[model samples]
Target: MDDEVRELNLTIDLCLRIGEVLLSSGAGAADVTATMQSVAHHLGLRRPDTDVTFTGLSMSYQRSPEEPPIVLLRQVKQRDIDYDILTRVDHLVRDVLAGRLDLFLARSQMATIVSVPRSRRRWAITLGWGVMCAAVAFFLGGNVVVAGTAFLAAAAIDRLQLLMSRRRLPTFYLQVAGGFVATLFAVGVASTDLPADPSLVVTANIIMLLAGIGFMGAIQDALTGFYVTSGARIIEAMMATAGIIAGVSGGLSVGALFGVSVGRFDPGRMLDVEGLAIVVVGSAVAAAAFAFSSYAPRRSLAPIALIASGATAIHALVIAQDIGRTWAAGLAAFFVGLVAYAVAGRVRVPPLVVAVSAIVPLLPGLSIYRGLSLLADGGSGTSMGLLAMITAASVAIALASGVILGEYVAQPLKKEARRLEDRLAGPRLVGPLRAKGRPR
Candidate 1:
């Protein structure tokens, strides 16, 4: 009985680990069942030798060779399942763990349910990204210190405001004030000129923020077959683009009162690899800090370092090649998802932790920065150099979108692996199904 208990505990542990991995890899019930059976055999646990039946989440054993099979029509607790429920559970777990989740609501809803370590790490990651944004602003030729402070401050403040909204500022006011606060850093600190022209830095900041939101929403919605949602997200993106115009127009108009002029952006200046590496370190730190802010698990961060840096390098190379990274991203994400699934067969860490982390390097941060900046700068994006910004933004969106779509396709199979694990822990009939001299 003690041995049985130990085996039972191992089985549950294995189930959880496998489930987490399969869910991230986008596996379905079959994958879960298969993964479970494999784990059980390896752990030397009692498992059904015959085929298992799965109704999405629950599972029950079929007749087998051992003793007469129990004619139990019991609902599989963790065994049988609905694909939708499983997927939802997987997503909730994955996003929340990675610090990519929108945690303000989660924290409000489940403050009692969270651990301290998880929460702190998410916060740390968020602040770290703020630093990265600062680094990126410098590369865009903003005064480095000013850009750095502005980026970090804006991110930190926004996160803090979001956390403290219980004090009751209207969202509109909040956004407006948030906009003021965030943009102030760009204008006051970065000394980035607003030119009484279009595309002032403030306008640029608002637009970029909106675009990032829209881009992420669109990708997620589209992948989930939420075409309406995707359409809405795209529309929001467009609206944000318009907002960029408005903000820049307003700032530029204000600047015009001073008879000041806007300047052209020259992309010819580049960051060397060494400098870019430093930037990546900042990006990873930012992501990790953001993760902690979101209340994600502390243990989940090391993967971010590996995945983000590698992704950044690949992204840099892709940019240098002037090749389309959209399709490339899709292909890359697909393979990553698929291979991660395979790896879960052995090691049961959810791929989402690493997959998302690894790909953070490829996010469309720069495109967002440039497009909004162009809108703020106004006039023809031509001549004074908005074209390049527009193009870079386009490419960034495509890459981000492609990565999202690819990951969507891969999440289902991952769930299947988890279902398999749950289905295996049941009674069987007659003789154990003979394997090819191997445990089934």
Candidate 2:
């Protein structure tokens, strides 16, 4: 009830709000905790103990060794990526650190940040998903008909998922439903005389579904020793993936009952100049579409596309040399992370935003679809199916680990550059002042 207590409450609120936004936007737990703690310290709270989990965040502030700490907790029940909001929050943190914003102003800014309306780009997102999936289909060697089928299938899945989201349906269920629609449509198309590779449609749609979960953040947290949060993230991703697998399997079984035989997967060539160009162009479109679907700022779109295209071009070149898929993906992801750190700062977008979106084109969707298809066949490919599953897991891990290693390589130089910039820019407005919590 006192001024000191009120101020403490407000400070805690602001810290947790920032953390929630970062976590929900797919940042690693370590980053969220460190950032929240930094904001707390800069706001005059010393040595705050912060705990961040998948479902909630907590921070405790102690006045002294003698007094009990003031503890606060905020639960995060829902999460979606909104990079527009993320950029604002990122700037807000920098402004607060520079002492350009005091408690009242900071609170006001936080309120505005939270209250800003969501973008009315649902149609754009739907169209982007369709285009992304269609482009991926072409990259994977699908013919024109297959690409069109993938576009229609992905667009339908997006609409259905959006509808289910508004109804509060669970993500696992949505994944399952999405997979069902994709498979059913692809198989149905295959049943006709389309002369196209329908399997590519399933693979393309799988990649789109996988994009909804943040596997990179999960892996980063696990590698960084945030076991609890990492475990939760991994579980969520696995459950969603499993739902897709189950749905695909179910659809195939039903198709077989109706006497429809979906064609098996055949990975097309990637060695030719035309193929390589397709890979680059498709990757750029896929990444840009993903960025749009996540509501990234328009200014950031072109940079994201460039990163994705270059990364995938590297991946294609590596694959052309007969390198293993896992190694190729890892190498390309490393390039993505390395390039992202340099370019992202120049574009005024977070590296993770571009890195994660750019990697979408390279996910092991074909491997997953192959594994599921083998499982649905019910005989003679059990070992191959197992290998495909292993490959998928390995590719996922390699993609995430490579990016982390790249960031580790980039951080030192980035920090030195930051220090140099600060030195040249001179002191900020706050001058690192330590004011009392209570109002006079």
Candidate 2 at residue 349, lDDT? 70
Residue range 6-101, candidate 2, lDDT tens digits: 999899999899888888888888777767766887888976888999999999888888988899999976766788787778778878988899
Task: Quantify how close model 1 is to the true structure by its C-alpha RMSD in Å.
Answer: 12.1
TM-score per candidate: 0.53, 0.92
Q: Which ten residues in a row are the worst by lDDT in model 1?
A: 426-435
Instruction: Estimate, for each residue in 1-440, the C-alpha lDDT of model 1 and write its tens digit.
Output: 47654445434443444344342223333334444454444344346342322212322233246634332222332211122233233444344344454333323323333221322343554565465445444433455454555466557555755664556653334444545455444444334443221112342234224422335435544543445535644664555454444444454444446554333333323334546665456445544433333333445555545444555555445545655545444444444444433342233244433444344434443444445456555688533336545554565466445444444454335554333222222110001111111244
User: Could you tell me the TM-score of candidate 2?
Assistant: 0.92
Candidate 2, after superposition: displacement of residue 368 in Å? 0.3
Residue runs of model 1 more than 4 Å from their true location after superposition: 1-118, 121-129, 138-144, 159-180, 190-217, 236-249, 259-265, 268-276, 324-365, 372-393, 405-440
Q: What is residue 239's positional error in candidate 2, in angstroms?
A: 0.5
